[model samples]
Target: MTAPEDAIRARRRLTNKLIAGREAQRLRPFFAADARLIPGGGGLILGADAIVDAFAQQFHAPGFVAYVRTPETVEVDAAGETAAETGRWTGNGQSGAYMAAWRKAAGQWIIESELFVTLA
Candidate 1:
């Protein structure tokens, strides 16, 4: 598959892992060391470690099931080195939108930044 297609599939798998609460398997392998996260309501979280820690806390919330709905799409830059996945996600009785930016290196795509905005 093309890099962009790979990125799109990877994001879906990551979302499934998140929904299943498989943090160790889902995050460490897919997030860059300097990745940043902007989870809704929470300001900015910088660094992969910090983001992981914050998510660990979030996973404790009851009924937390992170998932993306249909109509999601990924856009790859002309250079093919960067891509963005935008879609709607729902979990913990709340639905929202998410945009995850990814960077490709050594034929692998890893999340470089992510932003989650709650709409409901």
Candidate 2:
């Protein structure tokens, strides 16, 4: 449909799969540059390979299993084929928010960037 819708859907799919311990199936939609690890991290991952590597690491991490994104707070911002999203993430007796930048490409929403910091 639209960038906003696509982004939200992608987010849902990604989180759902992860929460289910199914990261393999969740790898398809993420773009190469989507591997920034942390939004605005300044570590600049330039392509899909980098993105996959970064995300795969997180997906395989010990504490990563405890992380879950609460679906109720998902929001997408659509502007010029790009959408930014913020969602609630909780687990391990801790919680925070994640910000992701998405770009519409090839009729699909692909994450372009992402970052997370603790919530107050």
Candidate 3:
């Protein structure tokens, strides 16, 4: 893996840890200001603040279980400033595939967008 790939993977691991710990507020740094997310159930969430808010709600929901994403592939663009990660995610008895787009800004890798699809 290249440096950008390694960095993205590390960020993703930290993100999983934050979610597991239910520390939604700490997730802000992992995403870009205008980040977007599409949940496994198929709804669009815009902006880092909104995304974090959605996560906070899920974390506090009854019977909620934290999601963990295991990357199957990380492809970095030629410019090394962007990457796409495809992975499998599981939580709350649900499992699915997810894709995340990452961007490097100010020497840090952050998520720009993500889309998830529940398969089972």
- Highest lDDT, which number? 3
Which stretches of candidate 2 lie above 4 Å from their native place?
Answer: 1-3, 39-47, 58-64, 71-80
**Per-model TM values vs. the true structure:** 0.82, 0.63, 0.96
Order of quality (lDDT):
3, 1, 2
Rate residue 82 of model 3 by lDDT: 91
lDDT of each: 0.75, 0.60, 0.95
- Stretches of candidate 3 off by over 4 Å are none
Q: Candidate 3 at residue 34, lDDT?
A: 95
Q: Rank by TM-score, descending?
A: 3, 1, 2
Question: Candidate 1, which ten residues in sequence have the lowest lDDT sum?
Answer: 62-71
Off by over 4 Å in 1: 1-3, 67-71
Task: Provide backbone clash counts, one per model.
Answer: 0, 6, 0
lDDT of 1 by residue, 1-120 (tens): 566766566656765666466464366657889999888776999998887787677777776565554327888899988887888877667778888888887878888988888899
Clash pairs (backbone) in predicted model 3: none
**lDDT score at residue 68, model 3, on the 0-100 scale:** 99
> How does candidate 3 fare on TM-score?
0.96
